[model samples]
Target: MTTRISAVPRPAPAVDLAVPFADCHITSDAQAAVLRVLQSGWVTTGREVAAFETEFAAAVGAEYAVAVSSCTQGIELALRSLGLPPGSLVLSSTMTFCGAVQAIMHAGHQPVLVDVDPATGLPTPATVRTAVQAFGRPAALTVVHWAGDVADVPALAEAAGVPLDHVVVDAAHALGTYAGDAPVGSGPGATCFSFYATKNLPLGEGGMITTDDAARADWLRKARLHGMTADAWRRYLPGGSWRYNVADAGLKANMTDIQAAMGRAQLTHFPSWQRRRAQIAAQYDEQLAGLPGVGLPHRPAPGQGTHAWHLYPIRLRLNGGIDRDEVIAALSERAIGTSVHFIPVHRLAYFSQAALIPSAGLTGADALFGQLLSLPMYPRLSGAQVDAVCAAITGIAHQGISGKGTE
Candidate 1:
């Protein structure tokens, strides 16, 4: 008997047809927005940034929304406004980006760690309680809404037993996610929303800090750049003096009017963009169901809150013959791209030692990390492309053997 070779090869599992991840989806509105800023001549920190700040605050239902260069800077500035004593503990959930931890550290405070809800990988009342018990009374609490899922924000704030001022939300992923009738920023001390290249309201790079407190808002606006008593826009306005006061030493983190122009354009498309994201997420949920080793990203109940669908993170189930890594590799081979929402702030080498990780002593972050996988999700992602990605996942998920390639 001779072994014969077949001429036709296996169709590389339908060559990944999913649309590229991180598509900015800038519309014709972007051109007009940019042109308006350009035509004004006075770009940099001008009327555009100020206008964007005002509009964004109104959009988020906050009394004030200050624009900044980046979400990390926004978080830092928010923490600085808190003015907690140096070395004081600033508690925050562990299952989050390193920026939150970096903000706390740079604020000259001790970062205390808190774990998140086991199922959703979001902060919960219990996690907050445990953090308080473990880390003691913190100078403040940094509440993070990871993966666009609003955590038990109110509950966590209540459990902390601190005044509302102690709450500072790193809501980079919650620009559009809401709890109850309020968006992520409302009812908390301050919530920082990102407008990064991959965010729901991508603006190349920018962020907003929404707050109800007038004093804090004023301080943040001043603190973003050298703690000047007045902003550059004010100085350059007609009849305004170049003379200004530096109340405190601040960092250079102000957002330019050009970036704000992009923000304004993105905001116009926000409602439709979010709808598209939700639809894509729903499609993923429907198409990926019952695929072995793959669990669709959990969605919060509509009555409980509004979900922005900033990320569609599926946890690769270990029991499935195909593990997370193998499936991810298979998807990669087909051209579908993916990323882990986070590696857990405490786990990152940059903030490892002496860092306050919300899940420091627990297995919470570790458990969440072991199986997490974020699928490509964006307004530009097409229905057919979504289907192709889902089909690839479906095939890989069903294959027997739990491989580590998913995350």
Candidate 2:
């Protein structure tokens, strides 16, 4: 069956309001939770953080959860907890945020970059095997769930000849995501999640780490707060002693009660938000699927797990004479916001000059980078807004095909 979008150009909609690439949706319950924290007299990591950790663990089907100040620190802490020797190599995708790579460095390890599947922007088992062959076996593997799509961490680890315990997931875009029947955090490694202002569960700033290992969970608890024998809540609260000891030098990356409170409230509304995100993604898939020169986001196979839809990234077939940036400008002109998912970590100036080794040719990531375009994706985005964005894109596709050049 031949599938194609009409060649006729749709008139650009009136630009009364500009759609933002990302926006935070704070519910009234979230506001109340934050307010309660502000009035509690205890604002730092305490009871609220503990309760949030418990709830979050249950939400993600993990045995234990540790709240952190940021996803970067969560990755660093998870890597450090592994007790790997300093300067040990860690395998990660080249098509990921630089912060994840920096986390490996922060944990006193060298990063070995690996190529990704061009279509999904995720590393496959074959790519992991190639990296292992080129850079020798790494002490650990940090797999990123790019754009809310889950990567098979256990499989990737096996391919790299690394154990499941050595796998760490940079799940910044994958909180509600799943792998088969299990939630992302329920997998083999320490999975880290983000709650940045633009993330699905926005708390202004926060992160979480989930693991099944009790010992590691305990280590993470103390490690997040300077390896203290007892946190502030334990020392200052009733029936608590003032004495404490620092077991190991650790990062001050504990999440505060304020953030935890907001996180809990956000969790309450998370299911509905996830549904809305999926709906928006479906709208894009339906509208943009048959458009010439437009490649829709990758959809996971049945039973592979559901995408969290953190980003609605589409690829442009640049060979069709449609420039990705030009299309971006056209969307901007129509008050439709868009952004690139990432600039490959290796391409960044710091990483380019760093000691990081590319285990294999990064042709896949490199090719996907030039064509990537992330459209506005958030829980609060209305259906009308989605239609407008799709319309603008459709118009751009038609123009490009006719050699009008997105002018």
TM per prediction: 0.91, 0.94
Candidate 2 structure quality by residue, lDDT tens digits, 156-185: 988988899889999999988888888899
RMSD in order of candidates:
4.5, 3.9
Residue 149 Cα positional deviation in candidate 2, in Å, after optimal superposition: 1.0
Candidate 1 similarity to native, TM-score: 0.91
Global fold similarity of model 2 (TM-score): 0.94
lDDT, residue 92, model 2: 86
In model 1, the runs with Cα more than 4 Å from the true position are 1-18, 318-321, 357-360, 401-407
Clashes of each: 16, 0
- Candidate 1: tens digits of C-alpha lDDT, residues 187-274: 6488888988889888778889989889988888889988998787898888999999988869899999888987887788899888
Worst 10 residues of 1 by lDDT: 1-10
